[model samples]
Target: MLAKANRITSADDYRVIVRRGAKVAGAHTVSYLRSRESGTDARFGFIVSKKVGTAVRRNLVRRRLKAVCHEALGDGVCDVDVVVRALPSASAADWNEIRAEVLNALERRRARASIDAASQKGE
Candidate 1:
């Protein structure tokens, strides 16, 4: 379970992150990551739409995504806001599959941000 402090509760926060955050897309999900400078808790939001499935299926996918986020919560994700949007394929994905996809996307997004920062500093 994700803590309240680690959850993004506002629609505006979701919109801003989804629009401005760096994106990392996987077969089962798309992760949007934006850095902030305040605290160690990385906030997370999920979007499991009708395209993924009915209420039951969508909720299952959302729960699985949340579990992955909870499991992977760590220092690397600090000072960031993440929104995970489930793809249609996610309804059929098992926990391990969803976990791998989400975790890898987070890792890749962080890598991309670091690389961009390094390049900018070198210029």
Candidate 2:
């Protein structure tokens, strides 16, 4: 499990990410992210809805997401708030596929940040 400092704990934070932040899409999941102003560690949250399955299935999906986050963006990502939402397809996705998707999502998030920063600078 992720440490306290590396977890999103508030509904307000999650809502901000979902409503105003940019998204990174994966095959089995989607990540919404917002950059943090002061920190070097990345924080994360996972959301597996009932549409995925029962308690057992949701836990499995959460576990898979945590592993992918650790493997893909573990060290490179900076301080940010991230929420990973699982799709129904996630239940059947293998580790390799999930990892690929997570990486792709991270990359997209980075790119979006760059664009947003550039636009802010222009204004």
Off by over 4 Å in 1: 74-76, 116-123
lDDT for every model?
0.88, 0.81
For all candidates, the clash counts are: 0, 0
Q: Candidate 1, residue 22: CA error in Å?
A: 0.8
List the candidates' TM-scores in order: 0.88, 0.84
- The window of 10 residues in a row where model 1 has the poorest summed lDDT is 71-80
Q: What tens digits encode model 1's per-residue C-alpha lDDT throughout 6-112?
A: 99999999999999998888889999989888567888999998999999999999889888888778544777899999999999988888898888887886787
